[model samples]
Target: MTASLPVAPDARQKPVIAVVGPTGTGKSDLAIALAQRLGGECINADSMQFYRGMDIGTAKLAEDEMGGVPHHLLDILDVTDEASVAVFQRQARELFDEVRARGNYPILVGGSGLYVRAALDHLEFPDTDPAVRARLEAELQERGRGVLHARLAELDPASAQRVNDDRRLVRALEVIEVTGRPFSSFMPVRQYVQPAIQIGLNGPRELLHERLHQRVVKMAEVGLLNEVAELETRGLRQGKTASRAIGYREFLKVLDSQRGVLQEEYSVADAITDTVVATRQFARRQITWFSADERVRWIDFTDPASLSHALRAVTDA
Candidate 1:
C-alpha cells in the first residue's frame, strides 16, 4: 500500500501527470510534490537512471528523498542491459494502468523527452536487423557521426536535425532503410494514448547552464569517479548503452588516465568540464524536442507561484 489513500478504479478519471524538461530544472522535485498533492505514484523516464548500480551518475534520489511515494521502473536493469524504448513503452504502460486502476495518480517524470512521449503517445518503433545495425555502427565509427548525420540529412532532413547522439543518428538511418521512409514519419503526433497532463519545467538559459555546471562539479566531488570505477568492474565498459552515458563515459576517460593508459593524464577537472558541456548540449536537445509539441504547458518551476500554476493546469486539463 502507498502512503496516499488508494482510490477504486471507478472512483473517477484522473489524467496521467508528466513532469518534463531539461536536467537540473527540478522536474523530479516537482513530480514528487505533484504526486503527493494528487495522491499519486511516479514512473521514471530518465534512460540512464534505470540501472541498478548507477545511482551516483544518474542522480537517483535516495529513498528518504522519495517522501514515501512509490516509484516504478527504476533500478530494473543491470549496467550491461540495453534500454529499449519499445520494451519500456510496454512495461511503463502496464505499470501506469495498474496505478490508475488502484485509483492513484501515475506521475511520469524525466528529462528523456522521447521516452516520455513513447509512454504517453501513440508512438511506434520499427524492428531492427542486427546485420544492418552492425554495418551502420561500423560506418559510424569509421566515418564519424557527422558523415552519417549528413547522409541522414540528405535522406531525411527532418529526422537528421533532431538527432544529437551518434547512436540515435545511426538508428534513424537504419529505420529509414528498414521502413523505406523518412524516420520522422514514425514520430509521435500531438496526441496522448491516455488522458494526460504534460508540464514542462524550465528556467533562464544562463541560470540553467550554471546549475548544470555546478551539478557536474558536485557529482565529481561526491564520489562520481569512484562510482564509475566500481561500474567498470561490473562490465560497464562492455555495455553499449550504459557505457556511453554522460557521467560514466567522461569518468571512464579519467579511469584510463589513472591506470596510466594514456600518454597525457586526464584530470577530474577535465571530466567535469566535459560533462558540463555534454549536459548543456543535451539540455538544448531536450528543450527542442519538447518545444515541438504544443501540448506541454511550459512553466518556470523555480518560481514560488509555479505550484499554484501547475495545480491549476493539471486540475483544468
Candidate 2:
C-alpha cells in the first residue's frame, strides 16, 4: 500500500503512522486495531502512562485490552524516574528502528503532543545539569513562579511564548542557572526524522469535554481509588513528579481531605469532580499543543468516514 507520507531518501527507514488527538479520543484503540490488521506494533507516546502501578488512573490499556498486539514503552518506568522528551525521543527512535527491522509498521499513539512532536521532528535538546536544576527548583520554591516567568520573558520571549507558564518559568530559571544564558538561545531548528503518515482525531469542544467526563467516570468505576491507595501506601508524596501526575495529585488531595488537611473543604466526591474537570482542561491544552504543528493532517473526529478517509490517504501514496 502506498502511504501518503513525506518523502525520505531511504526506503530502509519504514514509514510511521502516528495516531494522535486529545485524551479519550480512541486513539489507542484505533492504533492497536490497525496494528493487528496491518502487521504493525504500537509504541506509546504518552507522558504519564509510563509510570508503573498507575494503570487505572492513567487509563493505561491492560494486556487483554491490547488485543494481542505487541506494544512498547508502557509500564517501563518507575514513578521516581523522570522521563524527559529527549530521552523518550531517543528510545522511541530505537523502537521504531527495531520495529522496521522486523518488517512491521510502527504505530505511534498518544495524547502527549510534545512527545509526538519531538519524535516526528527529531528535536535536539540541551543537556540537563542536575546541580543547575536543583538550584532552580530551590529558587522556585522560595521566590515563586511569577518571578521566574518574568525573568524568562525578558530573556527568551520565543520559548516563553510556546511553553506553559509553569514549565517555562521553571525551565528558564534552570537554563539561567546552568549556562548563564537564556533558554531561548538553545532552541534547535527542527529536522524531519521520519516519513510519517499523520492522522488527527478531533471533535467539537463540547463532545471532547463530554468524552473526557465519561472517561473519568469509567476510571472511578474501574478502581482508580485502589490504584491511588496503593501508591500512597508505597509512600509516594504529593510533591514528587510522579505523584503530581494529574490523577495521582488530585487523589492525593482527596486523601489529605480525609485527614482534614485541605482548607478548601474538599471531600472525596469533590475531589472526583474536580479531577474530572481538571482532566478536561488538560485535554484542551493538549489540543492547543498539537495544533501548533503544521505537518499533521487533521480530521474532524465526529464524521464516521474520517478514519476511512485518513487510511485511504495513507494507502494512496
Candidate 3:
C-alpha cells in the first residue's frame, strides 16, 4: 500500500498470477518460465519446502534449477518450527505486494491448497487456543483417527468429508469447538484481495501416476534416505508438522529399522513404494481441491501448447 516505491510502467495495475496443480506436474518449471516471460519472481507456498533441511524430500529446486529467477518464502523455517497457514498468509501477501509495488510480478506457486488461497483470497483464520488444540490432539492420538473423524462427522459433516487425515481432522474439530462454526463455513468467496490470475496444470491420471512414481524413485535414488537421516540429527522427529510429511515419514520409518524398535519388517524399496502411493493419493486430493475453483484457467502439463495457453491467460488477464 505504500506509494514511495517506484512502480514499473509496464506492470499492470494488479497482477499476481498463481500456478497450481498436483505434484509431479512441473508447477515450478511452469512458474519459472512464466516468471521469465512476465518479469516476475516466484513466492513458494509449499509448506514442506519451508523447512531448511528438507530439500530432497520436498523436491526443492537447486539454484541452477531456478533458471536465475529469484524466489521467496523458501527455507525460512527450522524443521522444529511449526508451519501455519495464517502466518504464511501474512508473509506471502507482504512479499506479493512488495514485488508488485517495485514493478516486478509476483508469481505464487505451490500445491498446498490452503496456503495458496490464504495468500490470494479474502480468507481469515480464527484464533487458536493451544490448550484446546492440545486436548483435541491428545484425544486423536489416544482414540485413533476414526473415532475423532466420526466425532467431526457428527459436529461438522462437510468439513469432516473434506479431510480424512488425523491432524487436519483434529484441527477442524478444534476450530469448530473454539469458534462454534463449521470449518467449511470459512471457505473463501470467489474474490481476490488484488487483481490476480490463477493457472492450473493438469495431465492424464495415468501420466500423473507414472510421473509421481518416477519422481519418487529418483528422490529415493538420490539420497532421500540420507537427507532424512541428517534431518533426524537436527530434530526432525520432534517436529509435529515436519515429522509427518509423506516422503520424510516413510523414510523415517525406514530409519527406525536401524534400531530394533519397529516390529514389522520393511526395506528401502518398501519405503519408496509407500511414498509413491501416498504421493499419488495426495496428488488426487490436490486435483480435487483445485478443480472446484471455476476461475482457474487450467492447462495440460504434458502438452507444449499449455505454455502458450498459460502465457495467454496472464497476458489477457
Candidate 4:
C-alpha cells in the first residue's frame, strides 16, 4: 500500500526538491510521485541518462512511465558526446530557476552524486589548459590508466577515490598540474545555492545488491545487447563516457567476441554477470557519496511510508 502524499501549501517560494540515492532504489518513481503532488517538474541529474540511445541499460523511463509530468535533461546528448559537470551545472541551475518561475517546484532526480551536487550546491570548476590536458592525455596513453591513477592517488587521495573513470582521473591530475591545487579542493560544500530539500532512498545492502543483479538480468533479457549493438554503430565505442557505462561496456565485449575481434568468446551470460557486478559496485560508491552529505534526509525505500516521509521532508523544508 502507498501512503498519500500531502498537498503542498501555496507559497510564493517553493524549495528545490532533490530525489537522490543509489541505482535501482526507486529514485525515479519517487521523483514522479513528488512532482505529481507538488506541481513540480523533474530535472535529471543522471549523467548516462542524458545519452539518447541509452534507454534500456540506464533504466530510463519511457513517456508513459512519466505520468504526464515534464522531465528535463534526459536524452539531451548523443552517445558520442562527453558529459561535462560544469556544463550540466549551468544548464540545471537555469532549469531550476525556470521551473520555479512558473510556480512549480524543481525536482532533481538521479543517482549520479556529483551531478546532483553540481545542480544544487555552491560548486565551481577550475579552468583547463589545453596544453596541459594534451600532455596528460599523451601521458595516459603511454603510461596506462593504472600509472596515472596511482599518481593522482598520491597527489589527492580524496579525488582519487571519487573519480571512477579514466576521463575524470585524467581531469583530476590535470587540475592538480595546472592549478597547483588538489582536484578535491574544488568539490562543492554542503551548502545549497538556494533553499532545497534532498530525499534519499536506501534499504538493506543485501536487498539493494539483489535488486541490482535482477535489474541487470532483466535489461539483458529486454534487448540490452541489441541496444548496445545499435549504439556501437553510432560511435558508442568512441564515446569517452558512454563507452564506459557498466552494462554497455560489458556487452561490447560480447559484440567484439561475435565480430571475432577477441580470441575468447564472450557470452551474453558473461555480460550479464559482469554488468551486475559493476552496477553493484557503482551503487556502493553512490551510497558512500550521498551518505557523506548530512543534509540528505533518508527514508527506507522498502517502507510503505517512504513517499509520505519524502513529502513531509519537502513540506518541512
Could you report the Cα RMSD, in angstroms, for every candidate shown? Answer: 5.0, 5.4, 4.4, 6.4
- CA lDDT of each candidate? 0.88, 0.77, 0.89, 0.91
lDDT of 4 by residue, 85-116 (tens): 99999888778777776778899999899899
Q: Residue 202 deviation, candidate 3, in Å? A: 0.5
Residue 160 displacement in candidate 4 (angstroms): 12
Q: Report how far residue 86 has shifted in candidate 2, in Å.
A: 1.7
Per-residue lDDT tens digits for candidate 1, residues 10-107, read 63378889999888899888888888888899999999989988988888999999989999989988999999999889888877767877778889
If both were scored by lDDT, which would come out higher, candidate 3 or candidate 4? 4
Q: Considering only N, C-alpha and C atoms within 3 Å, which residue pairs clash in candidate 4?
A: none
Write the number of the candidate with greater lDDT, choosing between 2 and 3.
3
lDDT for 52 in candidate 3 is 97
Model 4 alpha-carbon miss at residue 190, Å? 1.4
Please rank every candidate by lDDT, starting with the best. Answer: 4, 3, 1, 2
Candidate 1: residue 73 lDDT (0-100): 89
* Candidate 3 lDDT for residue 239: 96
Model 4 accuracy (lDDT, Cα): 0.91
lDDT tens digits by residue: candidate 2, 165-260: 565567666776677776777764455686787777788888888878777778777877778888887655742557878777877787787778
Ranking, TM-score, top scorer first: 4, 3, 1, 2
- What tens-digit string does per-residue lDDT give for candidate 3 at 1-317? 23334555555476898999899999999999988887889999899999998999899999999999999899998889999999999888878767877678899999998888898899989868899999988887788888888888899889888996777887898889899998888878778998899999998999899989999999999999999999999999999899999999999999888676699877899999999999999999999999999988899998977878998998888
- Give the winner by lDDT: 4
